[model samples]
Target: MSNSNRTPEEQALMTKAAAVLPGGSLGNLRLDEEHAFVVREGRGSRVIDVSGNEYIDYLLGSGPMVLGHAHPKVIAAATEAMMKGTTFFTQNAYAIELAERIVEAMPCAEQVRFVSSGSEATYNALKVARAFRKREKILKFEGGYHGSHDYSLMSLAPSGNTPFPQPEPSSAGIPRAIQDTVLVAPFNDLNAVEDLLDRYHDELAAVIVEPVQRTIAPQPGFLPGLRELTNRYGVLLVYDEVVTGFRLAYGGAQEYYNAVPDIAAIGKIVGGGFPLAAIVGRREIMESYDQGSVTPDVYVPQSGTLNGNPVAAAAGLATLEVLREPGTYEAYHARAATLRNTLQRLFDEAEIPAQVSGIDMMFDVFFTEHPIVDYRSTLVDKTLNRIFDNTLLDNGILKSPGKLYVGACHSDEDIERTIEVFRLGVAAVRDA
Candidate 1:
């Protein structure tokens, strides 16, 4: 955990990385030099840094390592698949099998189309909706991340001066024309969504949302209300289930919440740590993808060279097979509940003004007294949150600054040790 122990080999790589890579880091995450680490290897619930320092991994490859790193079943499946061929650039049996699995498991997936990433899934989902409805605009919640695409980048981290439905571009490169197509509203606020849908329904193609936006779960009627509104307005309802897909339940959030959308995008655990994701929906909406199924005006063409690559499909199929086994979800939720409740109690006992948000599978504590329901509410104590996260890293727990993913592979011992580390993290926050 200390740089003093870093081997010359490790230090040399860091120097080389800095010379070749922008910001001396992968764009995914940046830690200060004192705490920066390059992952050497991962197995089960732990990751060993390049310097051989081990930490309890809570990032879980940013949420795809649900079965844990290099799971034997996943590895075996991928290896077996690789032996056959890596990529055919055409339809493969593994792709068909994985598509069948997704259609069977996901409530809204009557038909499934594969893509190479979650961003592609969302982007394509939007395209399909627009093609189907003959409308150009879509609504997304503020702070709800659909991925790094131009449309998704709007209002993702707005400073909050902008009013509802007005967009703020999170990144500079996004075209100015994109701002008009995306409308932003508060998460969990059904009224705002309804109002926007009412005004924009004629121009609105779909309403895309993360069922659980970041760490905030939807209030009881939120998702169902969205479904009702979208149906009434004749606009497609799209769930960006990239974070909640197979991780939430066997059927994902659509089944978990009993709120079926017209279409959905799924990724993360569905790929089993590989670069595979999908745009799935009703047969009618999904029909847009087939060049022969629709008129030229409405047809939406989508294809990725690596879409549904066999190795990823094999790993995904294996992961889903294991997930379907009885008691996997129950056991996963039980451990998650323990971690959630334990952290909340620790925060309370320490007299920290904290609100733990998110579902059991993934959540984080916001260092604030206010309830966390939207992006603006979460900014109440950025300084405190920043210190708390760094404390977690200092104590050897790797996690996203925004969320900590709990995996089925995390052992009882791992959870116990993590609790001890969580206490250390909370204490450091208290002292700071």
Candidate 2:
């Protein structure tokens, strides 16, 4: 755990933490010391580890810190709201403001319901879709993670070889029977989805997808085609914008594709590093929660203790304010494009079989010469991913263990520094 033989103090802390945690060992400290920057704090693109090692950060808390960690404005607003009131179970002015902001930001969001996390948001969206269609079956793309809920767990594997109209649970503890309620379709395979829908149209409730395909962006027009199919089939189209929201654009992926979903599940950057998420959709679909509904008994009951908690909403509002700023997105995204271009050029010059793909604030480095169009493509190589993992972390610059996200806080200088680190890391792996 410690660099030069573990100091007594370091040993004590490690032992204590290990005792309390299940995965006790520190597995992958990319930096040689293995103590690899624990982290005292972060500001802008740089993070100072507990050991006092500072490095430019591209991990960006998986993708939420678009404005970067602890932006002064976000911190101040959260602080002010915390001072006024951390939470008040009942509705408040702050909540209304946050809702208005989300509604304005999402072109398709006619109504918004706040929740504690992306999982909760997606779960509720699934429920809303089922209820609206008065059906039980939900369709989801392979390898699209829509949170850990049982229904969403089905069909996440890229292999369509799993039986038709159903799939085994991607994770244990999820009942195999739940798979019957989920229909699996490959990403970007419109023909496959059409066939599945034809078979299960009557029972199909919603078809959910991630526009950008996460690690790979969908080929152009793929999203529009999906939208058209869903509409024609009378199935509610749900967009899981958890990672793409605010990062792809202020209005999310929907804006870029010029297509709107019946329901949109949002989280990530909207929370500004806080725990907040929401399901925004058509008014009728969202209004099913209205008190004294015809079948209040049958209405979905989704509530969490921390749903719309004041502090998270305050942070979300502050985050949105920053995102809403004119030209803010342009400045940060330009930086990201530059980084991607530079990195791609570096890989090309090195003659590495690799390609990079992403939009706006998020990108993933894939070590494949072939175009990775979807999850199916991503499954082709395992060792290449391992090579990427080892090399990137071995250097001082830290990124997501897998997918990486750059933040608004990252400057031109930060991008250049990361490029240099990346070149060295790649060269190290090549030599090794």
Candidate 3:
């Protein structure tokens, strides 16, 4: 598994990164030392490492580079905005235009409040929900990752099997008191959600969830059921569409699923591969952020130095413009569906017990026969999954540890090559 091809210069940089950066990473893509390599640049559907090795990048900057890295339109827009000066504390034209586009696109977004990252967007979404509802507790689905915030960390990756409606902090340093303010429920389970909502609806401000929880698609009626339950209980429904935003559809998961939320946190593709995210919602609920709209006690104060940076907004605008073009999603989804289905067939043909989970546009293989309907079901042979990922990496197909993001930038040739690699990965797992 050692990367013997590492150049002297790349090796030196790796050593330097190890000396300075924690775990030699910026808190993402923690690869083994042997397989890890510093990226030089990305273009179209490929990334070249410092050692001059090229990889077909299915990770796509963790699902933001839908049009691929260094797209001419995105680069030009960002460059023009950068030339005009990057950040301003005051509202800018680009941010305003972007907000208007989001309002038109998202089913739930009557108004928009920009933020710098998905984490900040979700945090503020919950805060505003609590403020608007005048409640304290929030319910989140188990293993539904909204962000790195204290509330999001609850039940993110609990080692032990905790009981229903109870949360186990996934990370250290989260205060024990914070656990009481948060509740956890299994994704795609309507009965569990209804029972919890019935018992704790009075204390709950919002029921936040990912419409597509990680790679697991919602069982039919799940999203609609959640919407009905949240409405019946008088609790705000917040959709964390950071990964699914523009990638799923122009209007995001809400539009694709046809189940609108009271509030939504959108990022990833909306930023066009930049540091930007937003909390968007209906006007009545979003008014919590406006000091003048609400009393001081109920107003939720939120701001960031780089919130709605003009450069990021311009890139997002350009990205959305491309996404709005007719047939864009049709082509993107068809190509990705080809790859996803082909991979599943390959694994099945090889007699490897696997399930290629998630939607066509984004998915990954689980080396298990059990259905991947919820978080607990996702627990399977980690070693086999690692081997499969490494096999793809060795063959110059790069993907995230959990999911493979399919981008519109993937060419016909790129998909064909990846299919070849997928066969190799399937065989590797079969042998293992």
Best-fitting candidate, scored by lDDT: 3
lDDT of every predicted structure (CA atoms): 0.90, 0.78, 0.93
The reply for model 3, stretches above 4 Å from the true place, is none
How far is each candidate from the true structure, as Cα RMSD in Å?
A: 1.1, 2.8, 0.9
lDDT per residue, candidate 1, 331-380, as tens digits? 99999989999999999999998998998999988888888888888877
- Tens-digit lDDT track for model 2 on 20-80? 7554545422433354345568888877665455667777776788887789888998898
| lDDT by residue (tens digit), candidate 3, 184-266 | 99999999999999999999999999989889999999999999999999999999999989888899999999999999999
Instruction: Give per-model TM-scores.
Output: 0.98, 0.92, 0.99
Better of 2 and 3 by lDDT: 3
